[model samples]
Target: MKLSVALIEPEHEVNVGHIARVMKNFGVNELFLVNPKFDSKKATIFAVHGKDLLTKSKIIYFKDLRKFDLLIGTTAIYSNNRSNVIRDSINPSQLVKIIADSKQSICFLVGRESTGLNNTELSICDIVVSIDTGTAYRTLNISHALAILLYEIKKNSFQKKTNLATVHERVLLIDYALKLAKVSGYRRHKTSLLAMALKRFLGRNLLTSKETMLMVTLFRQALLTIERKRRKMF
Candidate 1:
């Protein structure tokens, strides 16, 4: 398994530098900055031995993240309400278990220091994971959270087995499912929830590339059939 880190609109140069250093410690070479607000030169000063990592980090748009095989979002907030599907998350240990034996390149997305990832941003992720601090003050420093997550992933995860579906493939599968639902006359609001739930469900389980394609083919066939039937009736 290949590991990488992505900081989303980071607010602090210090945090950026520290995260780079942590990534180096875990043997992660790719650092992706999404609309970062920090100065590169200033952040490099704090990177110390990891200065090269900070200097070489790629600046990318949010949409470019679909290239990775998996995107694991980090969050400090936890929610128990089933209706609040976006805020629902798994712990770091559980995350290690879920992807332990999977062969995939995974990116860990860390949000801003003050607000973390908003509901819209969280919804974009395949899976959202929260670090269990076990305190009323659950918020963790951006670098600290990355350190914990990387450490757990490094210590517990091992590579083996089939290639997992890339984020782009999974996303296309979801889009086809939604299209099929729309063609089948499902309600608009209900379709929205269905999309959210399906994304999370797919993230929780490891799906081989072939399996994902099979499912995508199923949805596409259903959609085509529905459209043909409706057109004949008209």
Candidate 2:
């Protein structure tokens, strides 16, 4: 898996530098900073060997999250309530399981130091992850949390040699699937849920470019078939 780290509006330059150092420790080179508050120069003092990352990090927006084939969000706050799906999260080990065999490009998003990822950002993520503290103190330092995540991923997961579908291709396939769902008589509410559910299925499992294309074709053909039958009935 091609892994990247994205810090969403990081508040402290020290944390950014520390996280970058940890990322380099785990062999992760790509860093993305979204609307950061601290100066890159200040952070480099802490980075030591990872000083280049602070200088070379990409600045991105919230909408740009979709550019990643799989986006994993980190949250200090999570709930057991089934109704609260946005905060529902898996542990870092579970995250390793999800990406162990996939060649897809993945990004792990770390939120602000004080509040963590908001509901809107969590909803956009393919999966939300929380490190198990096994105690009352659930929140961890931003750099520590990021270190745990990257260490687990680097230790457990291996990059596979496969021609996986790009984020754009998978997104197009998802849109086509939603179209197929609408034509197949699924209710609007169900279609929305299907969109979320489909992301888990498509993102966790590795699909080759050819496999994704086949699925898209099947959806289009089904939609066309439904349209023809409807016209004949009219």
Best model number under lDDT:
1
lDDT string for model 2 (120-165, tens) is 8887888888988999899999999999888787777566637887
In candidate 1, what residue range of length 10 has the lowest lDDT sum? 157-166
CA lDDT scores, all candidates in order: 0.87, 0.84
lDDT of 1 by residue, 1-234 (tens): 788888899989898999988888888999999999998999998888888998889999988887777788988889988888888899988888888967687888899998998888888777899988888999999999998988887788455657777777888999999998887778998877899988998998878789999999999998888888989999
Best by TM-score: 1
What value does the lDDT take at residue 67 in candidate 1?
77
In order of appearance, the predictions have TM-scores of: 0.86, 0.85
Enumerate residue pairs that collide in model 1: none
How high is the lDDT of residue 202 in model 2? 68
Clashing pairs in 2: 1-159
